[model samples]
Target: MKRRNFLSLGSALAGSALYAGAMPGAAAAGRDRLRIGMIGTGMRGQVLLRELVRRDDVEVAALCDIEPIMLGRAVQMVTAAGKPAPATFGENGDGYAYRRMLDSGKLDGVIIATPWEWHAQMAIDAMQAKVPVGCEVVAGVSLQDHWNVLDAQLKTGTPYMLLENVCYRRDVLAVLRMVRSGLFGELVHLQGGYQHDLRAVKFNSGDPTKPYGGGVEFGAKGWSEARWRTEHSVRRNGELYPSHGIGPCAMYTNINRGNRFTRINAFASKAAGLHDYVVRNGGEDHPNARTRFQLGDIVTTTLACDNGETIILQHDTSLPRPYSLGFRVQGTRGLWMDLNRSVHVEGISKPHEWDDARVWFEKYDHPLWRKYGEQAAGAGHGGMDFFVIHAFIEALKENAPMPIDIYDAITWSAITPLSEQSIALGFHTLDFPDFTGGKWRTRKPIFAFDDRY
Candidate 1:
């Protein structure tokens, strides 16, 4: 249990803890290999498991899923990796088995990667049990859910991290470095969105024998992992997936630091894209065609921050479009745009023009990326996924503060329910819930941009 260098575990485990000091049990398990439990081994869960299984100092001690097939697949994966087959839990109705797994008293932490609805409850249970949690992004289904998760972490003093891998993207981190260095002086506004073409993914039910979106399906059954996601689209209207856009932007603009989102006004375009796609592929009489989806093909959300900055976020996925987050960070001195890969800085470039962003990327790429870029590139989502998982593992090994703490998780996830309320009230201004409880005013930024191991 002696304190040891986290990097000594391995290169994959090597990374900065950012904030120093260990969590409640860091020293107790310092020498012992970290034992992590996996919850919800669906599509995304499997991807994370694969990355985790590749690590040497970590052990996938347990796996949980409602679906027996998914759980078996994950178990098979652990065995295939020539590692010990992890203990398995599945489908005891009403999440009973998941809670039982938590009570097993066998995990340093549990990673929740289930459908959207399950994240809040699972995280609450884990923290209450004095176990740290690393949950996948998008906090929960509603603003209140975010508050509950936030309250749990605060009350229990347990660490909770939102797995926002996009924040680890090389370019995004580079942008963060510049933001912190005053390269983008006096941050005035920021914009980003989840603009992927999810037409097929939203409709896919994971039934390989049954074609979905007129093609072979993959992963879990019923419409995109438990049918919850499609139901979310059918029932709600707002920025359903906001973290991918707001996560990195929040860091760049220093949310929970000097800046906090104060008010939000959102508008949703008419919902037509999903219905049209369903009819085109499955005919007008198809079940999905008859379902009236409230979610818009395009949702524009505007957020006002306490630091005199405004953020514009968009949710565009139901319609045909190429994948792009449409990340844009602007300030008095310079601006960056992701789609075109361009950047412009006052006094550093021609007047009112953009130079290739690659120039800046090559020159000012984040030190983490510069060192681990090749390894990360071999992982998912252009290597952002690798760093995110790596950072989480290291945090557990060191028992240090989480990279994406509960405050960031709730703030980014709360946007969904807040936007829904705003849209329902005809784009009326709604105050953002202060999950930090005013600590943002004095709390030092926990996310460090310094280069280190």
Candidate 2:
């Protein structure tokens, strides 16, 4: 895992094609339907399973998870959808059971919904096994993990897509259309962040009936995300979950396509929210109250781009607040802010007055949404999940490049480690790694370029 010079490595590897074409066993090669596999059947994994089962073009070929209860629940879901029971693994506490599923030679592609730490290794294993991968957010924990995953894909020529659904959000896509069409004019500064209250999610009771709140427990006593996600908050002080915020922003600026993040500096506020929540909800004398959390209540990171646009991101999950990504896209002529759902233009809007963004969003709604809005309904995360999954399937079926390719995946996920490095060094600005090997200068924008995907 020694750090290799990406600039030189990218230069050496730049000539090779990076498109995600059909693999040897892909459905694109004469198969009637896709044979897919599921890696984790937890709460989030179940949501993905529901979406997969509903797709007529896909079959849940295999399932894996350490918890049998979750595995049973997922089995019930597939059966309820009328799909055949998929081969199940991980029931015997084998952490590497997923590797067996990948080696089974029954999968066309795999969707990884496992915990964050497992994402990198599973993806690497899938690529090495020549299985196409649609992995959930934060591709890897360390910067080297990103490089390793990228290297695996380059060596094996396997398709890998980061299931970053926020990039397909209705308003976010609409703004993307606007940005491409010059509605926002020349892009200047943009802001987005994961600024939602997750105090309850960070500490959930193990009770099945009351899974989210009603208790202050984590690790063995916690449920779902509480079991693992809270551990990161307790050990790290950076933008732990940044893809939701940076994904759409990267799309707007064409990050890792024609532009790239050059450098970044991050600042973190003193830690207080998690402990305060425990004291207020669970008594101060609660055993968990004594646990120290390292994650800041609010972490702000500023990134400079090679294209002259500056991006700011904030991570604020421990505090109490209504959910909002805090998205703001500004340019020389106009700006859009998701916090207030308002937009302002130099001439289209009144003199320095804000206009309802709904009008503009409706006018420029992405073709993909306009065409598949009905189909996307009821899918998780306000229906964006359907689009992300659809993109993966369609790309694999067509043997075309992924809309969100490996370069984009690593660049977006690299923010977490880079932000951590910056904060650990007294908010020092650090040069961003060029994961694309300087190929970005010629890479054209494909994400949401049309409704076909």
Candidates' TM-scores? 0.91, 0.93
Q: Residue-wise lDDT of candidate 1 within 1-453, one digit each (tens)?
A: 001211121122224345433366765655446889989987789888988898887899999987776788889999999999998887553456888788999988889999888899999999999888999988888777888888899899988989999888888888876766667677788899899877777776456433245432222445444255677887899998999999888887668865688999999999999888878877777555678889999999999988788999999988998899999998888999999999999999899888998888877777788777777767888887888888888777766778788888999999999999999999999988788888777554544544442
lDDT of each: 0.80, 0.86
| Model 1, global lDDT | 0.80
lDDT digits (tens) for residues 1-453 of candidate 2: 011222232233322322323245544454457999999999898888888999999999999999888899999999999999999999999999999999988899999999999999999999999899999998999989999999999999998999999988999988877876677677889999999898888787777656687788988899888888899999999988888999888877877766889999999999999999888889989998999999999999999988788999999999889999999999878999999999998888999799999999989887789889999999999998898899888877867678788988999998999999999999999999999898887775554435765
Tell me how many clashing residue pairs each candidate has: 1, 0
Worst 10 residues of 1 by lDDT: 1-10
Candidate 2 Cα deviation (angstroms), residue 135: 0.3
On TM-score, the candidate that comes out on top is: 2
On a 0 to 100 scale, what is the lDDT of residue 249 in model 2? 88
